[model samples]
Target: MENLTLEMSKNTNTLQEQQLKLIEGNFTKSEALKIINNVVNVKINFHKLQRLSKIEGNVNDKCTYDNSRISELIDDQADMKSFLRSLEVNGKNIKISSTINITVEE
Candidate 1:
């Protein structure tokens, strides 16, 4: 019911665990992407990589331990502000930059 997917590849063993470790080791997104590509030759974006690492790296685990908690994620006001600031002020949002081109392929 959760629509989960199981992507099988040759070197897919314990990949998320290694990715979580790389994230814990404070490697940047580009660094992680390059390492993954160099090791296994996968061309995944940083956003997808972040999804596998967000919980351990950036998220607080206090909400899950609470029984009567309203939210499962760390979505407090300060967290939201910090998230927005990272997206806007950090200047790493490549999607909004002017180098993107939209051309139809026929």
Candidate 2:
């Protein structure tokens, strides 16, 4: 009974360690920001299209009329890229220092 209890305790500790490692391994901010940015962009694009359609009565017409706004569009794209780059850099710094431990019962 003593040996059995010792073995059970050892297995429990190993299981706890593995669970901790698994949780740590799953902790990430990289993909999360990517998903958030994608969602925000989609929502922005949807609203922009809707507003443009309401203004011009046709989506194609709005695009053609806004042809001179190419510079503004380019600037927006640049800003979005900059924001995403910053997010990625910050996420990398945070993830790198995070520690994880694993143990296995033999």
Candidate 3:
């Protein structure tokens, strides 16, 4: 059992060792807003399309999850917009960092 555990520990598991730095950049306030807003809008649009597809495909299936997500993203956008607005300096740079971690669920 000890040897088996040691072998397993030595093995390289790609699925468990997955991490990607998706976005890392510094930009002006307007540039940061544009980049962040574009990403959020894409997510919202994706959910909207999914909800529409579900509605058209099934009569009884309601897109509660997608609707909730869309609403949440919209609220996040509003909050971020307000926060970005507070940075009045056009020359000041905002740093954006995003990381993605992938895991397998049982």
Candidate with maximal TM-score: 3
Better structure of 1 and 2 per TM-score: 2
Off by over 4 Å in 1: 1-24, 42-106
Candidate 3 per-residue lDDT, tens place, 1-106, comes to: 1111111121256645456665676777877788779989999998888778767967787546536788999999999989998886757678887766666676
Q: Worst 10-residue stretch by lDDT in candidate 3?
A: 1-10
Cα displacement (angstroms), candidate 3, residue 10, comes to: 16
Question: lDDT (0-100) at residue 75 of candidate 3?
Answer: 99
Clashing pairs in 2: none
lDDT of each residue in 1-105, candidate 1, tens digit only: 111122333325543322111112323334433333343322223334444554565465442332222231223434534544454324242221112123334
Residue 102 in model 1: shift from native, Å? 46
In terms of lDDT, the poorest run of 10 residues in model 2 is: 1-10
- Sort the candidates on TM-score, descending order: 3, 2, 1
After superposing candidate 2, which stretches have Cα over 4 Å from the reference?
Answer: 1-27, 57-106
Clashes of each: 0, 0, 0
lDDT of every predicted structure (CA atoms): 0.33, 0.44, 0.72
